[model samples]
Target chain A: MDRVSLIDRVSQGMKNLLVLMLVLLTGCAQQQLRGTGDLGVVIERAAGRIVVVDSSAHATLGTVEGLGDLSHASVVFSRDGRYAYVFGRDGGITKVDLLTQNIARRVVQAGNSIGGAISQDGRLVVAQNYEPGGIKVFDAETLELLADIPSTFGNNGQRSKVVGLADLPGNRFAYALFEAGEIWVADLSDPKHPQLTKYCDIGRQPYDGLVTPDGRYYLAGLFGEDGIALVDLWKPEQGARKILAHYGRGEEKLPVFKMPHLRGWAVAGGRAYLPAVGRHEVLVVDTSTWQEVGRISVKGQPVFVMARPDARQVWVNFAFPDNGWVQVIDTLDNRLIDTLAPGKAVLHLEFTPKGEQVWISARDDNRVMIYDTLTRKPVGELPAQSPSGIFFTSRAGRIGF
Target chain B: MKSLCLLMCFSLAMQASAQSTAEPTPARQHELIRLVRQDCGSCHGMTLKGGLGLPLLPDSLRDKPASSLAATVVHGRPGTAMPPWKTILAEGEAEWIVSRLLTGFPKE
Candidate 1:
């Protein structure tokens, strides 16, 4: 053969070898293509780590560490459910990749933080800090600082610890100040020039806040008083109004072991199920009228009154001495139906995407218990180190998760 | 013989004083550390740098009187979210927690 033809044959052979090597490399690496919808993270608070688990398989995939002070950790997922942005107690924001089960990016943005929220369009991640109280917004992709809106109040312009930060439509955020007793709605459409609407004197010490599932109403739970401050997103000119203003009136308040969380306010059957502060009862209010409709007596001071996906049943967890027990409330009848002892110090509960199973994190027991929603029996268990929060990818599609 | 008797008396006095102070057992101390790091950590923060509550770090608490801190832990501060721990802790245990807070809390 001529020299030119021989060179052509050699180049063709090299191309064939390259294709074969590519196939072998992919196969040998054992890279499995999968979706992240069934994946979730369990916050190991004491260990400052997160265990990524697959709900469909009931198995842990991998563990990611180096997250500092996850004692009050909360997580929000990317729109695609491929990433989890964990907000740590020490103001560390960690972005973990669900597919790779590793940290994508991490930043300690503040001295202290309570929780955080992702903007409506999923372009911004906001952390509410407690040290120099304010909400710092960041670019979701790079975790770069986009804006810093200090929660300044009072005559001296002292910053107040921000709480109950939630996302609204059109790239806006609604949060309450625990020390200032004020609620502020920030329009971050133009992250740099944020248009802020402040509502003052909402109540004394509004400990936490939450936005309705529809993103139309913002509610702040008062710690210093006996009511909830409600703001209609559509009607900002009217300001906030107090609902259930006399919830604990005429009754001596019991010592609250833990502050009831308002973030998980249950809305089922057109009624909102809320935990009455310092009371062993769940208050039901008509969402349309924002009026008290009923109250169900529970085992202890309810910490999380969360509704199942279908809104047919609500699960309630307690604080302190009663934390070991979990109760089920039938929303149709508005009555306590069943109670089960999951484990010691049950810290949190999360329902599956379809609400077939519920995961309960028992911190002291160092395990997470999964129970069938219909049968109300323990179906599975996963060991963890002081797990506090269980977040599923399904939250990625929900508003105000 | 006289010196031995005096040594015995001194040892007895030390034991009596230690009993009066009522230091918790090692196991109980472990539980207390976990409780303060996790439960009280809910408000004061896990590292005790504070969240909704004031910082429990040694520097922040050193200036405060140990007895007052213990009393606050046992009886809780009225009109605030701080609830009385008397239901779960005794006076001595509260004092022990206060002392630990003043000198840096232990890790779990």
Candidate 2:
């Protein structure tokens, strides 16, 4: 071949190599998700006995101990899919390795660090101190206190409700201040000393706010007011835009004492599943429409709702049912298929990378349970020390062991 | 009998004064009751009589300032499970709540 043709051939070869690498990475992710293809459930069993149950088979698998009395915890995994951090409602974080199935280290976080988020790097963990309503940054691997960032946006005299923290790609973090009606965005690029970048004031009551999968917009779940407020994080100066839905749309005019509470939305197949606290239903919003197109009725007080990647199925857990269980809905028909009765009150649920297993954490049971997706049955359980808000790492190969 | 009657009148006057100072309209009063009984009723007593924390009555908060009391409600004490109230109560609403509490507990 001529010199010019040879150069073009070399460039073509390099392109093929990149494509092959991409395919290999995607396959490896699928392999890690093989065992946890369904759903993993975490239950805070009565009396703080944290256990993880295979939700499909309803069998207990892993166990952890010494989550203090009244020590309800919210558990989340690192971004790189290596560590599982279980945060006690009172103020302690138990860092566990997903690979080893063991508590790698434990750190006593300050105040009531109920909600947290892992950095994109999976090296730093930032949690919201519930009581004082401050921010605590920890070294994910060492489980050591790196910094306790007191919230300036949160007034000391005001009741501070820091409900949720979400990772904004890179090392930046976003947290919700329910009391102050504000969302604090901090740059954790420097994990040691996280610098406060922006204090985006959304409105009167902000519950749980999260950036879009693409990190373009930040949406806050408003409880004190009607509808979900959207903040243009890109042009944050423009303030928040209220995306009114049927949930709390007419709340101000309704004589009935019904207000939106504990609202969450999981984006899947270009749609969002938004559910109100008191309402026994789920609002389906087409992200493209920004309009409420459909609603699904779910029995019991469904608080936390999640959807599978393909948007084929949606999982919702009750907040008030005395016994504790999850509601599974088929998105195709928008109907309730089955109720996941795990015998413990579940506060939060997370899905494995490949959308196979659903992971649930019960504050009262202090355990994490895993459920298979195919059969919707309990297969195994991971003992979490007072687990609550559960999230998993879905970066690459690191997944449920 | 006369002394008892006088005490009753004094108590009524105190309550009336409390109500007037807080400037709670009948509607606002009803809203406050609903919140105290429902939202806070789970942990704090239904009547704000203090289940998890101390009572919210005048007798309980007589020693504390209205601002301090309001602050506690807005920004729950650090290191405790008491969640901050910024999201629950607005600034004006919190101050009004504190004012109502300072005026003395209403007799149910």
Top of the candidates by TM-score: 1
Model 2: DockQ score: 0.02
Tens-digit lDDT track of model 2 for A1-401: 79999999999999999999999999787556424322232534223334544444555546656654223345566655455677665566777654445678876766555556677767787777756667888888787778877765544556465755777766777776766777777887877767775555566666566666766666677765557777666776776677863465543321112222232346666777776534566777778767777778776545667776556888887644322778888877677898877656565677776678777765446566778877999877766655654444442222111
* Cα lDDT of model 2 by residue, B1-108, tens digit: 999999997986567556544455567667666565434533444455543344577788888888887787777765333556775456556777788678864422
Candidate 2 interface RMSD to the true structure: 10.3
Report, for every candidate in turn, its global Cα lDDT versus the true structure: 0.92, 0.62
Error of 2 at A339 (Å): 5.0
- Cα RMSD for predicted model 2: 17.5
TM for every model, in the order presented, reads 0.92, 0.62
Q: Model 2 misses residue B62 by how many Å?
A: 12
Q: Which residue pairs clash within candidate 1? A: none
For every candidate in turn, the CA RMSD to the true structure comes to: 5.6, 17.5
Candidate 1 whole-model C-alpha lDDT, 0 to 1? 0.92
